[model samples]
Target: MSQLFARVVRQAIATFDRKNVASFNKNFSVLKQLVDQLTPCDINLNMDLTTDEAFSRVGKAPVTYVNLMEDEEFEFSVFILRSGFTMPLHDHPVMHGILKVMSGSAMIESFTKEEATGSAGQQLLYDPDAVRIEVVQDEPRLCTNNDESVVLTPTKRNYHEITAVGGVAAFFDILSPPYDSNIPFYGRRKCSYYRVIPRNGESGKRTLERIPPPRDFYCDRGNYEPPDFLRA
Candidate 1:
């Protein structure tokens, strides 16, 4: 890892190990600052992967997860997005995280649940017009090579999707209390997909909603080639 990336992991530890909510919240911006300092080379990303090669393995492997640091407090990984690909909107269970663009650019649209949707596997009918919803990041802010960061929490913009721009894009992702069942505290990190539903004839920002996302997409897990300092 580079000195800058090491700094990010250090602060990430401090932020997740915080004893109280206020303390954790206070350290968020601090961690964000550290994440803002990362670059594509820090994680040894494959800058040469073409859009054709990337989308080729869509259901097989749409993104690459490069592990950096993993412990009790938090887990850090670099998620590389392929060209012309979009990570469909999804939820983060009860965890908190940070997304910092490490290379290329991305358009991120985030949202929060206006009403309780209950646990996964439960089926329910929904009325688009009746459900209360809000567009937290309406315009899908552009993020390029650590230029900006998006903070996520259980109550905040917990559900969102990301679209790669200008060929390929990647980000340094930090998640607290990782998605595990044994090390349970903030509940298991369960992920549920959702499909965005537009209101009536209006489109864009007029009104929007997210229903349980379809399960047609798929991907394969691959290993991360760590940098010199991050090598096991």
Candidate 2:
């Protein structure tokens, strides 16, 4: 199975064509077929997580990275998540993507930006006032060991966040034109951010409950602070 995945990775990289998006479209099934062969039951498929320590706290956040053929219209990255991990609601600029949970269950939330407003504009660098957020999809979706994957793109379900709900969840992802700088994170009804929001009690679990969804519809502001360990 590793050999097959390796071959598919190579094929994905080789198929990168800057001028034509169809190059990737033509080879899409190759990737789909390759990932189908992997199952959560196979421990050999565990992802190596030495690099992404910020996400390590949730458990292993192993990722398979691929380089695009310069000028290629699209590229791909695949990930293997341990039982309690998540990739929170985030956005990518001028690009589209997909996440097909190969096994287990996933809690996914999809959002779109709302127009900017009032104090939100002054407080946010991206004219937080200019941003508005809405929830498009939020639910626990079952992804069996060999089922169809989720699809994401600029046109389809474009912005979303995902969490591993059952055991480990593995997914295949595709992004077009690669990731650019203009992606955003949730701040309004679109998603929630983790901060030291005041809690009613000292209990660690209690803090989790006091947190509220982003009320201003903000996403991906570079000036935010993450957990200390995630700092590089």
Candidate 3:
């Protein structure tokens, strides 16, 4: 790994290794700074590929991913979205995520679940067959290589939908305590999709209903070759 990316990986391990909240926060702050300074060149990613060339190499998949590294503590990968394609609304159950756009641009819309307020909240219906929950949606933002990285915690802005704008886009993604089937109380740390439920006349109330993953969306694995800079 490049020195910059190696530092990022070390910081990620340090951040997640902390049992104290204060220590984790301090380490995570440093991790964020390192992530912010990263660029496509850092990984020797080619942002200049023509659409035809990209499709020829990765096939016609709407999305393609190249896994860089993974361990019990974290998984680092790169996801590339075809033009006008979307990753759909999804939640990273009990995980912390950092996303930094490396090429092109993308629009990100994120949401955080709202805490129950009172008796009404307590009485809200929950069916394992059809799960739904109230959430606060953040304003949609366009992200580019120059934009600061986006961070999501287990509780805050934990759900998001990402769409490629204009043309193809790629972003570096890091998830700490990477999804696993052995999370104690949480059962499996699985990814779940959601759909926004219309609020009718209720102001400030938005609901997200769990849904099956879209049939049209699928990710294909891309060939991950070490960057040319690394060879040098």
Best by lDDT: 3
Task: Please state the error at residue 185 of candidate 1 in Å.
Answer: 7.9
Candidate-wise lDDT, in order? 0.66, 0.44, 0.79
Write down the RMSD of candidate 3 (Cα, Å).
Answer: 4.1
Q: Compared with the true structure, what per-residue lDDT tens digits does model 2 show for residues 68-112?
A: 122344554445454666665555443545465655566665543
Assess candidate 2 and give its lDDT: 0.44
Judging by TM-score, tell me the better candidate of 2 and 3.
3
Candidate 1's displacement at residue 220, Å, is 3.5
CA shift at 169, candidate 1, in angstroms? 1.8
Could you tell which candidate, 1 or 2, scores higher by TM-score?
1
Candidate 3 lDDT score relative to the true structure? 0.79
Clashes of each: 4, 24, 0
Worst-scoring 10-residue span by lDDT in model 1: 123-132
Q: In model 1, state the lDDT of residue 64.
A: 66
Rank candidates by lDDT, best first: 3, 1, 2
Clashes of 1: 4
Whichever of 1 and 2 has more lDDT, that candidate is 1
Q: Which stretches in model 1 have alpha-carbon errors above 4 Å?
A: 18-22, 48-60, 115-137, 181-186, 200-216, 221-223, 227-232
How high a TM-score does candidate 2 get? 0.48
- How big is the positional error of residue 32 in model 1, measured in Å on the Cα after superposition? 0.3
